[model samples]
Target: MKKRIIAVLMSFVAVLTLSACTETVVELNTVSMFGGTDANRVVYESTIYAFENEHNIRVKDKSQSSDEEWKSTVISNFNTGNEPDVLQFFTGETAKPFVDAGLVMSIEDIRKEYPDYAKNIDDSVLGTHSVPTTGFVEGIFVNLDHFKSNEAKAYLDKDVWTWDEFKALCAKLVEDNADVEGYKPIAYGQNIPHYWIDHLVAAQLGPDYYNVIKGAEGEDKLTNALLKLSEIKDYLSYDETEEFSSQAFLDGKYTFQLDGSWFGGRIELENITVYPFPVVNEEYGSPLLSGFTSGFYITKKAWDNPKKRDLAVKFVEAMTSRETLTKFVTYGGGFAADSEAKPQNETKVQEALRLVSPRADFVVLPLGDASVAGTYAGLVEVQASFVNNQADTAKAAVKTYIEGQTD
Candidate 1:
């Protein structure tokens, strides 16, 4: 009778062990700029699937297109202590608040525990600023089909466009497409004018554009760039909220759009291609707006959770691995943060690299990312006294904003 009792107790213990093993799925929450129709999102999801299969962790992805509204929500979440476990955010002023609040984990801090935390990311590219950086580039996305239909096909044959040539093309596009229903020459809007500002300063300053953030000797160059914004005002369109809509471009109503390399993933059509924004400083040989600017950041919330801490680290490790960053570059996320990844096919991002690399005498980061907060604000503040007002007012407004910047 005692032997039978012992056997029954052993069986009960075995059942309890089985139930515990079955209940070991950890749900990790993450956020990023990978939602919408971005092709990179496919890779991101696939990685998450592989991670779940290899480990007992399930990722709760809450990603969306990164815009002003999305950024506001992220900041609000962190402020209220409802932030995600892992976050993919940018560097510069965008990251300053989070870093200052001690809400995110640094690669340095993580490495003390796991030496190879971000081994895939190089020391040179991991921005020592408040947050680390991956990389991104801005350029012009051209609808080749639209160009062909409008008889502007010949305009794209050149290696690099002179300022005169580029301006002429813009004028021609407006004239030819004015009567076409639902058609527009360019997809620029004052609501989002930084790319225009960025390329113009790059063209005006040549190699000196990078110093604008430092309050360097380029006030005249900046003024000239802002004046060009005035010159091109006729080509811009705004929605009800004075915001730029890339939807027009997506709807195939606009011929050209000044956008970033990351935007390439949104194109599913084969007729699209990319080029450097036109150059005014011919002596500078066509400057291209391209570089590393943002990256993945691990938050402190996950670090404090005993069960979530290691899982979050592993998730981040998989996300920032060399394999993933390479996929990011090849799939049109931007320039490779750690490797020279070329797409297997001729993606628009890869084509932009081919055309821009040899032709561009200089590569520059956007003023928003390159400059201090106040300087970038001065350059990009659309509500300021100068924007969309007049050529003289625009120039004066930008000059005041940039020149008046404090440390």
Candidate 2:
């Protein structure tokens, strides 16, 4: 009777062990900007799958297509105390609100724990994500094949071109391509006037000009930059829509278009080269308007739970690893935050890096973050008015807008 009782107890223990070994899956919630294009979707899904397989954690990805929409969703989720365990959001001013609200978890502990992983990422790039003041880099995409085929090649032979030379090249393209049905010298959209104004100002005034903007000299510089940008309106197509401008540039109807490196992934074209915006002042070299870091953050909710926190940190590390960042650059066409993962040669990203490397000091934070709050929006409005020829008194109109900012 004793032997039989012992045997029954052993059998029960074996069954319990088996049940524990085969327990249900652990699920983690994550949100990111990964659903926009097919390529981006593939890269993100594959990376997530790898993480899940390695970590034994299932991720419930709730990624959004549009950046604006993703930002709104994250803010709403945070307001309702439903923030995801891991969030992929923009860094800097865009992220300040969340950080101030105590929703974001500082990954300093995680970095200390995984020194090897942290070592690979550029401190400057990571600072942009963490410190809120260190800016991010943005590159311009150019259709190199179009330029090589056109007379504009001579002016673009060097990596850096003077503002006058760039304008002359545009004029030449417009004059030479006059008979080419839909050809335009350059791509322009009234919708993103802020981009035009920002690049022009950065090129003219250097990165530290934001401090100058608080006084008289900065105001003069801003006016000069705006006036320079206004001159390019003559070379742009009369169409006011971004869709029309982007399609025209992609279709090879325009010789040049100023945009972020992500533009490379969205368009299907070959021989597209990336370059810095032409500098108005040669002394400033070529300033790349970069000042927005978009990265992943772990939520406070996730950090409070040990199990969830481990998984979330692991996922963030994996997603930002050199291999994964390379994949991001491959599919997304932006500079990888991981400095060690060098971009492939003869690629658009490589060309951009080479062009911008000489004038690294010129990299500046976004106008909104560096200058007054809500300045970018107001500048955008001013740019549109100037481009539309509505600003009969350009300097006065811009000055009025600048003075109106409460910051």
Candidate 3:
């Protein structure tokens, strides 16, 4: 009888242990970072910390990977059901595949609960990516000290310049400083053509290029935009053998370069000024807005935990508030989502606002056909060939490459 009692007690203990194991709290993890490390990640951290404390939730913040590395890791974890609750992703057609595959969770419903999340944010800013995403603008950064007098302010103050006016100013600046020893006419990176393409498209076709083109040949505007891009080849630095455009610009080797506004903070330039990419078509009279999203995405692997998913939505909503969005964008060196928030860094912030505010019809969109992963890769290769005097096949090669990609 004692032995039977002992066995029964042991079985009861085993059952309790199993129940406890099943009930153990699972800590949810979220990874936040851009494709590369920078101030953006810092802002994300601050925002996440505040959110975690408020919600009594835990988030595992992981960041700092090359674009390729991030892509590979995100893809690997997703295929194996090991993805973090939230992962940083680029906004555009590129985000569609994962979203379509059911790898990303839609936060539209979440956005509704927190109206402030969507209120301050320009609905158009979300673009064609996910139903809800974050985006930053792309434009020229000016080193204000580079200019000697108020005359220098004229070009910057024009608010908007047609392509001709902008090119002429760039040429004038280069020509005026030509006699200065050790001056680079323009600091540019050849590894990517989207900056140049964005400028040209904005100039030639306005900002709608990102949303208008379903494919390469759907519209004649693609060809027209390509022609304008071909023209800018003369202005860009052929010697971008260096990987970083901001570094080259900071070193004072080049007068101007095309980069995201975040590059403004990468270096301390008290003399810096930011401007919109020049408008190419005077008739169209529209601002070409280069925008990118900085929103969080939920991977399918995290869907198993509905609580974690809800927490993720809450965190995103918290980060996107008008006050927080403005703070992040201001600190991160870009235009604020809320116009009234007023950036403390007035000069650069004002430049950004002026670039986007007027011309209500001005277009804002991402650079590539979101569906095509490597459309700009060929553009970069072609640019390199042009600089290498391998011009004979560069244009044809790019044209052929893009042509072949379509079918």
Candidate 4:
């Protein structure tokens, strides 16, 4: 009986030791475009750090800039069987390659195992991607301080702000700041002119940015839109050195800066306000660029692995949580993916939402985002034509966009 008792105690102790020693530690491989020079880098790192502290998962992040070359490399990794366990990438037509290949997992299939995953973000927001919005909108970021005077303030108060009204306001601003040498009413970088291009195209067509109804080379509407944009070039700064430099705008050199919602996060400017671009076309209301065009994706490789599957899902869930999404809005100036997520009070984030949140009924995205993959890069060429006073060659830039698929 004593020997039997000793054996039982030893077995119980062994079981206890085993239970205490056993733990799940997953090394999740992840990739994102939020690495270098990303506005949300600080918040993104903090979220990942917090997730690590709470879970037994250690992230092996391999993030890079989402440039064309990097995008090509992402597809290369998938082809070479080196895709990350979790990825943040563009959805829709951009991701159609990998998605069609059945390499990325879907929310519908994931629901079979984890029924309650990603239920926080609304269905309309989720659409077919089943991921929270991690995208931004483009708009006019104006220094309200520049407009505190009666002359500019009246423009804002006007019930109908048309292209004519906009031109007059620009002329007035130039006259007021006559002492400021070479002062431009609109600030933008010659290198990055896509923001204005998107709105110009949208004003030509409609606000349905998700599907650019019918835009192609030699289209008269597109030509007219580009022509209009160039017509107002006298008010636009053609600075190659400063790409919407916040410092330049803050210095009161430029009254209006064209930028994305992401540009205004945690900015210290006191009298900054965001307003919709003028309805230049009159036929179509000004198209405001905003909302999610991309999302966190889980690879089939991660889902197939018994160890990485749950950890991957948990990581995505944490990344897209209300708290994290609030950071995305408050710090990153992105649209809040979670309904509970709210921006910091009195921030431009709130101002941006005030400008576009009314259109929450639709899943609107940037006008350029709907273009075929690899075609957007060609826009840089298109911009050069107008910026250099060569409006006649703008159509040639559009022709550069080969009507072919690129992963």
TM-score for each predicted model, relative to the true structure = 0.54, 0.60, 0.56, 0.58
> In model 3, what is the error at residue 140, expressed in angstroms?
0.8
Tens-digit per-residue lDDT, 1-407, candidate 4: 99999999999999988776565556889998888988877877887888888985688898887999888988889989999999998776678878988998989998889998888875546745448545565667777665645787789774335778888898888777777787788887777777777777666666553234343433445555666766777888877745445568867678887776666763567677776677676766555566677789999999999988988899989888888887877776656766567778745546554445333333446545666766777766567676555755866665455333232
**Superposed model 4: Cα runs more than 4 Å off:** 5-86, 89-96, 106-137, 145-194, 202-218, 230-254, 260-269, 276-294, 299-314, 326-407
Query: How close to the true structure is residue 92 of candidate 1, measured as C-alpha lDDT?
Result: 60
CA RMSD of each candidate after superposition: 9.1, 7.0, 8.1, 6.9
Over 1-407, each residue of candidate 3 has an lDDT whose tens digit, in order, gives 99999999999999999898756544567665542646566667787778767766666776765477776776676678777776666665456557767777565644555444445555435433232333456666666545544555577667666677766676666666666665554566666666665556556655555444445453455445655544555656655554665576787656676666556556555565566666666665645354545566655556556667666656656666666766665666556544455556566535554345333345456445432566666655665554444544555655554554453
lDDT of 1 by residue, 184-204 (tens): 667766567678777777787
How far in Å is the alpha carbon of 15 misplaced in model 4?
4.2
Span of 10 residues, lowest total lDDT, candidate 2 = 127-136
Pitting candidate 3 against candidate 4, the one with the higher lDDT is 4
Q: Is candidate 1 or candidate 3 better by lDDT?
A: 1
Give the distance in Å from residue 362's predicted Cα in candidate 1 to where it truly belongs.
1.2
Candidate 2 lDDT over residue span 1-407, tens digit each = 99999999999999999898657556789987777674567877898998889977789999877567668778888899988888777776678878888887765755665555445555434542342211236655677655543467776667667778888887777667777887777788777765677777777777666656666665666777677766777887756887888888888777777776556656667666666677678776777566436677888888788778778777877787778776766675556655455555536546455345343435565565565655456667666556655545666766765686554
* Angstrom error at residue 71, model 3: 12
